[model samples]
Target chain A: MIPVLRAAVNTLVHVPDLVRYGSKPFREGSRPGSFLADLKARLRTFEDAAAYPPHQAFIGNLRPESLADIPSPWYGHPLPGASHQGPFGEILGQGPFYSMLEKADQFGLVSLDAGWTPPANGASAAAKGLMSAGARRGTEKEIRRRIGSGEALALEHEGALIGCIRRDHEEDESLAARVLLENLAAKASGAHALRLLLEKARLPAEEVDYILSCSEEAIGDRYNRGGGNLAKAIGEMAGCPNAAGTDIKAFCAAPVYALVHAAALVQAGVVRNAVVVGGGSLAKLGMKSHRHIEKRMPVLEDVLGGVAFWVGPDDGESPRLNLEMAGRHPSGRPSTPQGMMEALVCEPLARAGRKLREIDKYAVELHNPEVTLPAGAGDVPLTNYRTLAALAVIRGEIGREEIPAFIRDHGMPGFAPTQGHIPAGVPYLGHALAAMRAGTMKSAMVVAKGSLFLGRMTQQADGASIVVES
Target chain B: MDLDNQATIKQLVDAHGAENLVVVLGMSGEGVRIAAETLTTGDPSWAGPLAGVSLGLPVYHILEERVRTRLPAEIYAEKVQLMEMVLDVAQIEDALAGLRKTQAKRS
Candidate 1:
């Protein structure tokens, strides 16, 4: 048994963020255009997102009224205490995130608070720098002055620039401040959630034996592209220097992959404690918001989402990750939605000799509906749960008539933001643990799925699952 | 988008190299058709790069069947490339062997 001691989720949005970043100017040539005007005109206001039900849910501030009235196509209103600090994690706006990147690495941060200190060795960056996406165009001296300036410019005509992060050599564009800031934000956010888990477990930060960072950040200089050490870098920032770590990438399935690895390590007595953590994605911010704003719905997808948990030696107390019976979609399996559920749900239950009703809950891609619904992706979590129920009926584990009751009893409304990797099977963990402890629930199936073709590596859609018992 | 199933199957088979399939399956054309039929029954929603393997078994099974093909089996099985055809000597020899056996029995 591997216990998930604590879980945390955080949200952040830079309004002139992904939308501005993905515009033409950032890609090749620097010809500024009217894109910024269009963005500013229709961008989601902080108040609008702050009052959105899904945002409140991501930060763990969702009201019972909102949770109970789950099936309504409309989100009635924001919870009363939506502004309160989340029980799970904090919801930070971009201004604070800019400062967080600075605070994440004070030494790398320019003392001016807003700007970055330029690399002392101008020759290296000049020689080695290839203009990567978001690469800063400046001389070493110009960069140095920008760093030293008290009011260092954090924004240009379009996007926000959170000071530069440096590499071993001042000259590598691969370690450009832009890339470094992205990496640091991921690291800081992962550490933020890690620290929350540490507090929850009452365990010393240093006591963690290993850290597995499963975030979507791919940090690189021009030469390596995505040559990475993200997990180790995050471990350093999260105050777990003693813990050895590495990254595990499977797109949205990464956290579950990390969980399996962590559980294996703990269960095998290789480590006493291991933590799996992931930060939100900036690339995904405003990803689905154009549809929302167009439909007159709040751009509920405005916030980034994150989650972290400790996989420790089970105490015979906490909710248990049942490693013996895990479900996996073989690389040969079909990649349809029904195929995913069959491989990840029914097969695992078959292996365990348990019926569908025996499992109390199913947590599969919990992307909040407020965001996905308007975007035509539909209610992802509800769809996944209902798919599980449908599969159960097909397997004759339950009658078709029982499907409605099964959903009402076992399915949780989607609350996680569609932060690509974070939304997979992790959001309900906080609630699942509480339910298990309260004796209202016995076990759950945590399923994580991914589109493998995104990497162009394989045609197969990837998935994995594990039974978590009370 | 090109739903002409037979042409699509031929294109896929050619792209994937049926020389290996001819050697592996014994019944070359039948195996090709089976593989193609499995591929073209693709999910209408997913017309992306994964169209072939998305709904089918893992690419591994298509490459390596339930029976393992060993290293030494390729030593004598050679093929001539005449643009569209990979004429394998092994497949040719197998057919000749069957023809000879039947002819000798008739005689």
Candidate 2:
């Protein structure tokens, strides 16, 4: 069996307006020099404390929301205005992370206490300051001179160009995806981040049997371009002859689903190993930051995107794939809070022949409550987990009074960016794996739920679950 | 007869004597029609004497009406024995041999 998720790292990339909470308009001179200076100072303070290496920070000024303004068929909904509050608040809030941690605690889920939070203002000045004093500190004049000369705008945090995000003024989704991947690959030295991940796992290029990637769409000269070719890309990138790709598109649930898929492939002896990787997008970041920036609220500035992952064999002792279950209700059925909870949790557990109290922790839809709870009923993941816990208690699995403690112990408030699949499924994998390895908990469940009505194409609700055990 | 009826006839032949005798081979739609035509025309030079036959929908749906309208009346009236066989490479090889023998006798 593949070992559980060993470690993970993530970064969020966003425009200045998103970082500043819209008080500093995109147009120059909108904010006085003093205000800009103070803003920069606050950003520098937080940047110092963020754990990422200095070279990894990449800044972009152009807002993706502006480019995606025109109505397009590919998007599930009309792109929101630049100032919408919902996406931003949810992506940056600490409440979700707190709630998830609380839930995990309630269920006796053990995770690393070394969790990192993005600065209140998205800035890395503090991190830049930590670099060696001898490193070159180019002034704005030098930076402007380079931009004016039409040279490649090299972004330096302490002093290196780890990655960059460039805008492709193209309408075609597939072509755009290719451009982004190719651009980032070239800048990041042939996608060294992912290559390093494979190397760390001690998985040879030739031995790699499959690729499970979480790209939003698949299509290209690349393997499985549309939906099922992530493995192929990894194979090609890793220089493995047997590598091929497949896609999983459940927004946040994809990585866990991909993990389950890789495990199954190993069990079936189809191939000895597989890799699941996701490339982040700028469009999904700072979605609601524009609104906060406009309202002069604290802009959640950490918008640098990076990928990290899980690698191992199926049926092993380090971390075992203990259980996986999914719950979904077909569209058009009457919305029942009770029924939804049962379908989302109880039914799947029953089918797996497991009871509620037997599992140590249950990680359910742990999205930020500040972003989701204010929207109304059926918006928050924590609510769903609480309801499920209540149902489990009512079903006599535990005492009714234990619901509060159960939630507090079993959940983690959402600390992930609202990058769809990034936060929802895989964010907790790293910490959960570490805990399992330490033998703090025997087993934990990662659950995800998505709203299908937003797409309007289907009336079906979607969910998925996976258990990690030591 | 057109391709659809010819395919049906070929299926029938394979089902019956193909296994019992030996050797089986698949022919193109056009090839089956030509073989059926030679048999229907009472030409002694035609090689194969079919012992059994079956019919199936032609692979191409566009040819259905045309093949259906053109089938010979005598072939339609002939009762074919049906035999279900599991498809495997060895079984297919055996059926082909039977077809060759039938063709040799007819010729």
Candidate 3:
């Protein structure tokens, strides 16, 4: 049998306070004459979490199917049900997130106060979740000494002291406290998803033979800017003692790229179970805060998203990953939207002996409209669906008159955060798995595109797609 | 914006001058702000040839009321109807309005 996607896990780390630390915002706000105070004043408090609709949809507390009926612009219209735990995984809060940072730390760099304790609500249970996830806390210490000596950065929530992350090197700016916080956040969130993957797959940690990290963080010294093995570090944190790992980078397309690679490894019998995971991006938190503030809405990008997929040999029942139907965009192809749709969608369907109308769903760039619309980014997923609909019209699969209905039926609203790789195609896997199990959908395609030009390396766009069938 | 695009815009301005060119952008949201700023105040990103060269050109997003009202209804319906339906037009207009106001103050 060919490789199949056995299980998938999605997690969100609520780090509202950490929004100020996002790479773009932090870098700009730290400069002279920046409006740092105004930004801080606009950030939403944790008490507002219960009323946030997107937050509810993220943790599986609210079904994605229900979101279609919730009316457009889901910000002010808060959904009733709210929970930290979802069917896929939990939305770990700030206190537990801090605990995770310490848990990911190997060199005693993160120091939580001996008397410090997790909050008494959902986060209290998360402390136990961390332990079950195989996160270990070494010798706790009073972090005050290092903080007083200016060798550590205090981790604060709602203006209260929580813990601190110690600087790795006295003078090396590369090991500065801020950089460590970003790195630790990625590892912790990735570990959280890995743990969920093991639980969802009903496999022991040791059974995971290989780990692939497609996270967007660059974890290395200045001498070797992007050199990395974050995958191994995340596996260690998640207690995958036998899992050797490596990192893959393709910008937003990395997750799909990694998924294809995982399928190959499992099909080739190189690894019994290959896990592809991407951690939450701290730098992406509050990515659209300026627009959210202007619109008088909560910063919807406050949560950091993490996802993991367990790929193994086909179990006949699970959704088979049709590698033969995989699509790739060649460098010579035009990077226009229509060109992309042709390369990633049309060509793949043609080769797979399928029709455009046969695809039950298409998960494209899933950036949440709530976070994007206020900033004039428009509805990203809706635009992609429209493009697909137009392509269908041109192919005579659907008439121009059927475009609106076709788009509405084939695609759901964008619900993933704007954390680059986090929103790129894979977020719909958990929902697709459930739909396939219920027989509501027989076939779907996961597609993603990357802006390679963002790195200033090349103007070429990167993209890949794979068909999933029940 | 790329330097080549900015260089082309610069040549166009030099040939026809800034006053005659009312830059109209079909971009949505923050994209309108970036392109408008590039025309009116100069390239804010500074990666292009328009850096520090204030063209002070009047700019409008195709979704804005000013430009939408001017276009023939049938042509507008055919060309931009779908994009307008999906974009947050009011927010995009407001962003351009604010930028234009800021540029006016600077001039």
Best by lDDT: 3
What's the DockQ for every one of the candidates? 0.02, 0.01, 0.24
Q: Per-residue lDDT for B78 in model 2? A: 25
**lDDT tens readout by residue for model 1, A306-340:** 67778888676777778776788887777867777
Candidate 3 docking quality: incorrect, acceptable, medium or high: acceptable
Positional deviation of residue A360's Cα in model 3 after best superposition, in angstroms: 0.2
lDDT tens per residue, model 3, A383-443: 8898888778767788778988988778888888899998898888888888899989888
Of the candidates numbered 1 and 3, which has the greater lDDT value? 3
Model 1 / residue B52 / CA error / Å:
29
lDDT (Cα, tens digit) per residue for candidate 1, span B1-107:
23454345446666785443332322232233343334434434344333544233222221222332342444222211110121223443444345336445755
TM-score of chain A of each: 0.82, 0.61, 0.93
Ranking of predictions according to TM-score: 3, 1, 2
Q: What is the Cα-based lDDT of residue A423 in candidate 2?
A: 56
Give per-residue CA lDDT, model 2, range A271-370, as digits (tens): 6666676655434433444443344433333343334454456435466764455444445443344555566567767888988766677766544433
Candidate 2 lDDT by residue in tens digits, B1-107: 33444455456656774333321223322233344333333222333343232222122111233332354755322210000110122433344345445656776
TM-score of chain B of each: 0.22, 0.23, 0.90
Indicate the DockQ of the complex predicted as candidate 3.
0.24
- Candidate-wise lDDT, in order: 0.60, 0.43, 0.80
Worst 10 residues of 1 chain B by lDDT: B77-86
Show the lowest summed lDDT stretch of 10 residues, model 1 chain A: A122-131
